[model samples]
Each structure stands twice: as structure tokens, then as C-alpha cells.
Target: MNDIAPQVARRVLLLDGAMGTMIQSHHLDEEAYRWQGITAEGSSEILNLTRPEVIAQIHRSYLEAGADIIETNTFCANRINLLEYGLEDHVDIINRRACRIAREEARDRAYVAGVMGPTNHALSLASKLEDPAFRRFDFNDFHASYLEQALLLIEGGVDLFLIETVFDTLVAKSAIIAALDAMERLSVHVPIMVSVTFSDASRRTLSGQSLASFIETMAPFPLFSLGLNCSTGPEEMIDLIQEMSETSPF
Candidate 1:
């Protein structure tokens, strides 16, 4: 199947707005849904687990909102995050359901962006530069977790993968590599998009890398698109986009 993302990226793609904001508007209560799988009997996270219909409805709302790309609710659907809620066994189910819901909601009107957010693991520059000792976790563990999610999303017929809200470039690199590796393994030629969240003050990723450095570091990857998302208002995001447009290879 031909990938539609390359064409979309060439234009000014309109990604859906803040997910947390939209969810909050639902008044599900933050602590309740945030800790869903573990605390609440059928936590809001379990919406994918129990009420996938509701999830699809949310996706449809974004499409109606004029979003060219609608991300799946699987942002925190990875094994690590699921495990926190004692729902590790539901990782595959949750991710796959998320993709299915998004696909159903799009109805060919919009593209489904399989969402992958940062892992619960802590990321620090000293940890990245410090070698094995500084690092608190093993690379294999990290790769396996992400690879599982990416593979499932692809299998579920997601149009593209979006690695977003990344802070440390090192961790972001791990996610990028994992997704690429999964695509290679599955022989699925889906496009991948990587977006990092910047700190409020300097507008740089948590690893202290400038936008230029981030672009340079991610240049080798076969990314169909690269941009910033989350943790910034429209004005800051606009400036960051302009800076990236000037510096990025495009």
C-alpha cells in the first residue's frame, strides 16, 4: 500500500490538539483516569479496555475538528505504562484496540497516527553520557518494550507511527531505532514521525540539545517528518517550527 504520510508532510499537516485537555473536558477526573488500570476498577485508561466505542468517538471528534492526523489513544499503552496499572497483559490488546478505534473513526477521512509517548523511565543527560554505570536501565529492556508496541500498531493497520513528547534525545533515539527495527522485521514500510517536547524556558528538549542538534542527531533516520509537540503553547511552538524550518534538512 502506498504511504499517504509523505504527501501530507509536504503540506502543513494539522495534527489534533492537546489530548489531556480534551480528556479533562470529559470530567472523568484526572486521578481516576490517570491511574485507571490500577486504582479504579475500570480506570479511564481501560476505556480502551472496556469502552473502545468511546475512544473511537473521541477520534472522530478530532477529525471533525479539522485534524488531518488523528493519533491513537495508545500514547501510554506500552507494556511499561500498562504494567504500572497492573495491566501488562493488556498491552497488545490496548494498543491494537487503540489502532482499530482510530481506523474506524477516520473512516478514510483522516490518517491514523499510532501514538507512542515517552516511557515511564527517567531520562537525564548525565545518565545518557555516563555510560553503563550512569544508565539506570538496560537498552535491551527498553527496545523490547517499544518494539512490542510498534509491531502491534503496525499489525493493527496504523498508517504511521508518531514518537512524541520525548525529552532526552538518547531515549528518543532508542524509540526511533526500535520503531525502525520493528518495521524492518515486519517488512511494513510505514512512515515514522518523531516529535520532541521542549522545556518551557529554553525551548530545548530535556537533554539540553538545541533544535539544531536534535535535527542533526535524527537526520540519519528515515523519518518522513520531524516536528515538536506538547509542553508548549502555540506561540512557542510557532517559533520553534520556524527555527526548525530554517535549520532542519527538510
Candidate 2:
């Protein structure tokens, strides 16, 4: 994987649209995701190992569509999220395989951004508003899980890391740190792009942090870019994104 900073600095880069949505269009059944006689239906990450061709096809389509970047199908591939389906132990293989599939299809046509999604749990949010401090997982847990995922993603040859669709600033912070830590340990470096989601026009993270706070919280890191992703349509997000550009130093 090479540093994309120069190219990113030159012009606006186009990233492919939703991977899960495109996968759903195929309407694959439980058998498509089955591996080792165990069926983990709806887990797209497993498709990299069991059905690499399918993942490859999706990458090809996006590249053919003029996307400068195609994300590896590894979102929610982390141990914490995979535990719900009992596929936690297969995290490394799944992530590595996903990158291989994406890299093969990309083949110098586009950069492969390793997609690390926010896990199902949050470090701050709880079921009730009153229990603001109550969390099922802690910061260290998030960091460790992200570290394991980041290490293999780097080993698998991702051009950059996309810690995207973050709902919790705390979670994004953990991922950012883990990615940097992974690079230090492996003696390899790649740019990281962070994209957060605003719950609404309120312009606040789901965990209740204001956009300014989110920018302030992430300011210390040498991020490749900071922007918005899910949670609203373009018309609704334009102002927020413009505000981000004005407020963010990235």
C-alpha cells in the first residue's frame, strides 16, 4: 500500500457507494456466506473467504463506475461485532481476505480503503438518558479490538484506513489511536480518513458531542481528512459539511 496523500491533495477523490447495499442487491442466501460448515448469514465480511468472487465483482463494478477508491468489505469485521454471530475468532482471516479481494479487483485502478465501522456497542451511549456514564464496553476494549483489526488490515495491503460512519467520537478516537499504533508496530504507515455521522440537523454526534467538540477532539491527530457520511441526504448535510470545512483544520 502506498501513501495517497499526494493524490488526495491534488483533487477531489471519489469513493464508492455503499458495499452492504450493493451486496443486498445480489440477494444471497445463507449458503453464500457459509464457511467450514457454519452459516453466518448476512455477514458480508465472511464472503471474502467463502465467496471471494462475489466481493471481487462488487469491487470491479465500483472501479468501472469511475470511483477513485473502493472500500474493502470489512466493516463490522472486528471481534466485538463478530462475536454476536460467533465468528469472532475469524477476524484476522476475514479482514486479510477482504483486502486481497479488493486489491485484486482494484489492480492499480483504485485505492482500497480498509473500512472499519463503529462496533455495535458504544463507549458512552446507554439504553437510558439518565445512565449517560453506563457503557457495556470501555475505551480500552474498543482500542484493543480496533488494534487487532488495524494490524491485519495493514498486513493485507490497504492503501489507507477509513474509520467511517462514526456515531461516537470516543469510538473514532480509539480507532484513530489503534491505527497509528498498528503502523508503529508494523513499521508501515498509511493515511487515515475519518467520517462521522450527525444524528440530524442538530449537527451533533449520536453520543451527544457537538460538531465543534468532535473537531476539537480529533484535532490532535494527523488525519487525512475529516468529513460527514451517513444519517442525512446531501441537501441536509451540505451546510454541516461546509461548517466542518470551515471549522476543521484537516
lDDT of each: 0.76, 0.89
TM-score against native, each model: 0.87, 0.95
* Candidate 1: tens digits of C-alpha lDDT, residues 85-200: 78788788878778777888886677888888886665454445447346555567677888899899899888888899988777777788889998899987888888888988
Query: Which portions of model 2 miss their true places by more than 4 Å?
Result: 127-133
Q: Model 1: residues >4 Å from true position, as ranges?
A: 9-11, 29-44, 123-136
How much is the lDDT of residue 112 in candidate 1? 82
| Residue 160 CA displacement from its true place in model 2, Å | 0.6
Q: Give residue 113's error in model 2 in angstroms.
A: 0.6
